[model samples]
Target: MNPLLAGDRDVVISAATASGKTEAAFLPICSRLAEEPAEGIGVLYISPLKALITDQHRRLESLCEHVGLQITPWHGDVPKSLKTKLRRRPRGILLITPESLESLLIHQMGWLKTAFAPLRYIVIDEFHAFIGSERGCQLLSLLTRLGFLLDKEVPRVALSATLGDLVMVGKCLRPAEAGCEPAVIESAALKSSLKIQLRGYLIPDRPHDEDDNPVDTVQNQIVADLFSILRGKSHLVFANSRRWTEYFAAELADRCAVHALPNEFFPHHGNLAKELREQLEARLLEGRLPTTAVCTMTLELGIDIGSVDSVAQVAAPHSVASLRQRLGRSGRRGEAAVLRLFIKEQEVTADSGAADRLRFHTMRCAALISLLLKKWYEPPLTGLNHFSTLVHQVLAVIGQYGGARADQLHRLLCARGPFQETEPAAFAALLRSMGEDELISQTHDGQLVLGVKGENLVGHYSFFSVFKTPEEYRLEAGGKVLGTVPVDGPLLVDQIIIFAGKRWRIESVDDEKKVITLTKAKGGSPPLFLGDPLLVHDRVRQEMFALFESGECPVYFDAVARDHFEEAVSGFREWELADRPWLVSGANLWVFPWLGDRVVNALAILVTEQGFQAGNDDGILEVRNCSEAAFKQAIKTHLAGPRLTKKDLAARLEGSPIEKYDKWVPKSLRQQSQSGHFFDLEGAYQWLERKTDFLR
Candidate 1:
């Protein structure tokens, strides 16, 4: 209950969503600041999103006012005058993001060291989002660097709605380079009843044309169901992708028009304009209108969007943590949280892949929901070599100090810092490449400073973001800005497209400014807002396998979903996958490893290295032009030969840039990082061993 409020003692408060985590953290913080006044900024509150900062500010305004403290929300969106005011007189709680904190460390070290001299505690909201990510890595490095500047310890408090890997969470909260052990405070649960149903639909095997009578559209039916279920009520629909989000929102709005009803559904995603996103947030907070936001993961976290009636998921959720987080948005005030899952499986044909025939999406979603019920989630990933963040941090350090020695950079970063997987040789090689590539320059006295190229990179606004931001074209219709889209291919002037939950006709195109002008159109498909797909965990797949192996029908399935589940089970048995590791087709093999994406990728690489064409498609490994016997032989030979480490497995990997800062790091080091993080070689190897033994 006390939160162990002692000097330099870290704490982690993990509880259910909408369970007053911010108040829990700030109560003690504000109390301490009020009871014992300190000069300069007393507390530094970090958040993953600028919107989250706004949400927290609104929630804590009255509380801070009651405690006689000022809370300043600092980010790119805040007015420069307000930021200037805060800079001139730093006091009370300074709410910021990692990027803004990075900016201060680089450009205002003199002011920051003084301002943070009396900083008592650092609080990170949505702590899970930062762990095992590039931004998270940058955050940890910034904290460590801040500690070095202060020459003393500052205790940290982390707040989250969902968490796993308690040990890893503790370690990340207080890295080896800072503070004491983290004390965890977690609640039992939400404890409310869950009202859930998974409804399935079937898409026609043949594509429908405009001339086709009685056109069968699974999407339309699903949208119709959504309109009937969510009309005149507030809800959140997780459509899994920007394309789906836009399409579903547009379809629901169109349905409202056809029925002569007010539009209640709106689209929310990363591509939308900031003002539009803020508008949606404001409407949700107003709590008057019947609003439903069809969104991607943007609304999954704890962004105070008022109370909602229910949550709907359009596709199979990638992770249990995400599902749990999305479900947490509902079931407030002692009401049962309602969930309606919509799953659409394409009609099977002769050329349909194994995943489609087996209804893999349905199985996977069922597995994730099961795990969510069991209160199990994937642990935070560790033992990764984030050379990308290391590259950014090294440049950041040089910028902060104006110039840094090689030994100091190495000592503060790779030696005793977070990037322990990087060896001295790899790091030295990276520095040499940086110098050669003009990312950094070495003076005659051997001190590292930002080169002309490095200065250009770091001075740019995009430099502050550790994650990759794709180049996109801003879309405008009439005088208002709609949203932006990444043009994957050439765009014509009269192209019709769906964006921002509206159908648009391209009026004109300005390639130089990367802007597309549009006019309202009747219908169009969503453009390619290309992004990396989520990786599925092995546990989810294992549960899917268990479902088929054990012949158990889940109670949450609807009539259509039950039919799909039964069909999938029949197909699984017919293919004889339960007895063997693969199914044999003419001159090809369908490998069912039932592992996570990374391990599947690792096996694919190994098979490809052995002179076979392989690809991991939708959790099923497809080996082209390789028979079961040949594939079996390759595995046996690999098992008998020298163990292939990550480096060895990566020998045939394409050395392209995956992270934002990968271009600056040496090719070999980049390869090493990818080799370590991109694949679970050990996990793959164990599965291979088991499969081969079963074959024998």
Candidate 2:
């Protein structure tokens, strides 16, 4: 606070939940602002979600009351009248999101320049949420642009509960030379006890037949367990996907209704209405109904859902960092942190693949939980090139001043901002590409301005976001809007869909109005929501192997899970996986690198380049028309040569749109950027080199 009050250095507070990180940052800010009040906005607090801003606004009101300062929440949900008032007479702190800030800079730069003239500090809450994402890059550029406008550096403060890589986060908060090294305030380790359990279930595969019932035995078991464990407790059940969240919540509600109990289970995700989501939050906080929210990552952040008794996960988390944060939400008010992990896998058959036989889901969940106990988490890696964000900033800059020279745009966006990796030649080429697409046009005065197409884009409210979101259609039942779901194809009138924790049969569909009328159905499968496959870490895979090698089971497993574990061990021994890493399927060969997705992906590329048809089946690298000896020779040769480049592998993939403006980017640059962000080339290479050593 002293250093921050002096305006000499930035600060980063990495502390546990409910540890007063917010107060530590704002105490100095409020004190300084109280001593010398400003006529305009003094502190800019940026959060990743609007709900977080709303929560913080309520908390800060009382803190700022005595200081004679005000804190205003600004986002799309904020009323226009309130925004107009703030524009006319701005004061104190301004809490906003990155997209809102982008819009403000583009559409209200003149107002913002004057309103934020006395800005002294910038606070980024949930700092872990922004790292390694395009949103983070945009925020960094936005902060730099703001400083450029004010002609002075504004000190920064970052707060997070689960920050794994301090060096990278620090660099993100205060880039080199822009500000002094941040003052890190890392809190002591948590002393509270933690109780964790890994519960596993086996679901048998049955042929799909329309005449058969739609009920699933695995889902039934999960819902039954939830009904028994969380009957009257305030808890949270986190699913990996929204479809599952809706399904599980609806299933639990059905179970409760069977016994004539109140509906205490709710589904929360991004598709739900603001009113509905708020209702759920309020009910959970009230502690009257013994509510439990079966949700996705929407509730993982700090939204003040009150003290939860336990946190249950449907499967292995994408990373240990996320699991730790979810665990932090519980164990409040001097209670032990309680976590229950439920891993469900298909029952293995004679023809089942190695992954299914070994029970990948159970192994992965066990490994992640074990690693968490050791305080080992996935570290932050270098991020994407963010060319899409650069294009966004270009249009934003053009909109800000109406027109600007290409050199000015490059200097402001690339040379000085987070897009420093972009070179001058690439910038020129990108401008040319945009001109060809009529996104930007050159004026007779040698300035660039938004063209007709670009005007239509910049005119739309959604243009402020660099991330791509699909157009959604509203779902209504019994004249009540349940929620909205993103549609990728045509919708039929009789199609059965699951949403808002219930099954619905489509009654009518209106393409023009983007609405679907539905009637309640008995049961149905959850809708498919496609996303990038979760990448497993190499260390996690290694840990899975180690767990199998050991003759002991974790003490936290229940009786059912222990039985499943014994079965998995028996099957593992029968397969003799410890004696060999390669399995021959006729003329083809499958190599178990015992590595992660990235290394396997790299290996697939190397095999393909060597004239072998290669693809990844589960965790193994399968090569067509290749023997074990040939595959080994190719890998050894590649390891002895020069390192692989992003272009070498990215070229193998089809040219799919990976970012918002990827279609606008040149084909070569798009692939290059995607590879740099998505593929772990260096990690893959090092992993293979070690394998080569083992082979020798």
Question: Which candidate comes out best when scored by lDDT?
Answer: 1
Candidate 2 structure lDDT: 0.78
Clashing pairs in 1: none
TM-score of 2: 0.87
lDDT of 1 by residue, 1-696 (tens): 476356457888888889888888888788888998778899999999899999999899999999888889999999998888878988889999999999999889999999889999999999999988889888888888898999977888888888876666888775664445588888777646998899999988665554344344787889889999899989999998898899999999998899899888999998999898889988887879999999998998788997789999998788988888899888886899888899988788766667878998789889998888888888887778888899898998998899999999998887656777778888888888888889899999999999999999888877888987645778898877777776432243443455654456668777557677898764222222122336788898898999989768789999999999999999999888788788876666888888888887778777766777566666687777787778888878877888778777655443445578877876667667766665778888888888766555
lDDT of 2 by residue, 1-696 (tens): 377788667888988776788898899889999999999999999999998899899889998988999889999998898788788789999999999998988988888999999998999999888876677878888988898988888888999988876766787785535545688888877737999888888787766564344445787888898889998989999987888999999999998899999988999999899988989988988787799999988898888878889999987676788888899878888889999998887766654555666676777778888888877777665545777778878888888789999999888887778887788888888888888989999999999999887898899998888776645678888888887876532233444455654556668767558677899865222222112345677778887778887847889988868877777677667756666666665566767777777676666667667777665544567676688778778877776787568767667543344567766777667666766654567766676666664455
* Model 2: residue 345 alpha-carbon error in angstroms: 1.7
lDDT for model 1, please.
0.81
TM-score of each: 0.89, 0.87
Model 2 segments beyond 4 Å from truth? 176-180, 207-216, 470-530, 567-581, 585-588, 617-619, 637-644, 693-696
Native-to-model Cα distance after best TM-score fit, residue 642 in candidate 1, in Å? 2.4
Global lDDT scores for all candidate models: 0.81, 0.78
Clashes of 1: 0
lDDT (Cα, 0-100) at 379 in candidate 2: 69
